[model samples]
Target chain A: MKEISFKNDILPLGDKLYRLALRITCNKQEAEDVVQDTLIKLWEGREKLKEVDNLTVYAMTVCRNQALDHNAKHENKNISLEDSGVDGFDNQHMPDERLIYNQRYEIINELINRMPEKQRTVIQLRDIEGRNYQEISLMMNISLADVKVTLFRARQQLKEQLKKQKNGL
Target chain B: MDYKYIEQLLERYWQCETTLEEEQILHSFFKQHDVPEHLQQYADLFSYESEAAQECLSDDFKQRMLDMVDEEPAVEAKTIKFVSRITPLFKAAAVVAIALTIGNVAERTMQDNSVGDNAGAPSIADTYTRTEDITATIHIIDRNQSESMAKADTVQVDDITRR
Candidate 1:
């Protein structure tokens, strides 16, 4: 691929990469670092671009690996809320609306954070990112059945947790 | 207030039977306000998933990432250049070190062979003979110096008798 085309083609994957990184790392700064590292890796491997059938999936794999590596290194450290650091959402919404959304967002974030890494990652890919099972399985280097089972378990767990939270547990 | 469909989906959700689209439907249905009291408990969970999807890195982050990529080519090029420059020197040093080691070994071996030939002995025997000869030479020098001091004392005694 021409340098310009490579950049144009792969650049659009940033958000998807960011979301995947965020799900895995759960920290905005770490997510950004993962995305940066992923991009650098992709750029380094630009010569092999033609061999890649799905650039997005390849980039996602790289991002996921980077995030997981970061998580491993910082496994024992506490994840401070202030560590998200990057505020991607608009600040212009009405206070009440922001409050409600923020509350919902925090609740969901907490639930996702509580999930096992694999389940959280599978859910993020299957639900939020809308990737098919086969694609997720391929990207994550797992069997399709594994992907489905993980997603299923993740959703089931989320439901149970939500139910308990609703019941004031 | 009609939640019979959501209630059914919720049952399927727990059983892991709901498709992604169906799960999304459940999320959307529960995301709205005024969920019936019976279904309210599940609302927060689905709504949270829906909202969490929007948690993403900012545009500024994307721009910064692109900028970093933009800088990569230059950095890579410089690194390649740096390595290329240093590699020849490393190769030359390696070659010189190998040559010097070989030369030093060859010289030591030649010296050992010459000494062996002069002594008409095996290399190890020659080496021992050389060490023994050095020690004997030092002992003979020490004996000659002591005899010379004794002779000087006798000559002083004769000169005093003549006076």
Candidate 2:
């Protein structure tokens, strides 16, 4: 196995790890701390990391566990309203265009965040991260069938909510 | 202005039947300004998924992590057999598999799309090792915090100690 460099191989996983952490923790500061702890832990175990077949999945597993541990400790099960951190549009877009875009997305974001952890995490990994069922199963430590069921519920919930919102619900 | 393919894909998408590539196609279709009126209701859902992936940390956070890494000491490696670590997860997976029941409609939908059964999780000795490292680090942080309560500059170490 090729050796893993902390800078080239591991540091670049920060965003992916952060997204997973944020999905689980639902707090940006807590999510960042989870990623930091994950990175530090990864770096400390760099030797063992090389022995692992898939470092990305391994790193993610550790991150998921760490974030879960955080939630367990702090009882932060509900997603935070303050940390939605709406994405900004580029300057090229007109003000009206940007406002409409942000509003639509923010509503969708709220709908997603309101979901249960397993459903939302599946959506995060499958929809947001674009991970395959196999990879997601490994990272979440769930069966492939379970992954699909969880994602199915999540997408169906989003569809129902989106349709209602469109009808001015 | 034909959108038959997209409509079919959207149907599959709601059923969790669409592949990742097909899902990306939905996202791209919705990104355009000229989405058909009927499809516009679904646009924000796909668009949000695309944009949510772009969420990330700032460069300032990167710099702080680098500094903390520099300050941290080297970790001692321990030798634990791989089987010992993964045996429990296998049991857990078995339990989850037994407990998991796809609904009749979803199970039928999945029968057509099912590709492969899940093999057991890969060896992850590092996970156990990581748990140990965290426990040890927390112990150190606790000790330092108690001893250095008077010091105003314990903030750096406190960052790592923030579980």
List ranges where model 2 is wrong by over 4 Å: A76-94, B71-163
* lDDT for residue A109 in candidate 1, whole number 0-100: 74
Say which docking band candidate 1 falls in.
Answer: acceptable
Each candidate: how many clashes?
A: 0, 0
Q: What is the lDDT of residue B10 in candidate 2?
A: 90
Q: What's each prediction's TM-score?
A: 0.64, 0.68
lDDT of 1 by residue, B1-163 (tens): 5667888988887776777789888878877787888777667667766666676666787677667677666866897799999999999999999999999999999998888789776555555467778789888999999999999999999999999
Q: What is the interface RMSD of each candidate, in Å?
A: 2.2, 0.9
- Give the chain B TM-score for each candidate: 0.43, 0.44
Scored by lDDT, the top model is 2
Clashing pairs in 1: none
For model 1, the stretches where C-alpha displacement exceeds 4 angstroms are A1-6, A78-97, B71-163
lDDT of 2 by residue, B40-70 (tens): 8888887888888998988999988887776
Score candidate 1 by TM-score against the native.
Answer: 0.64
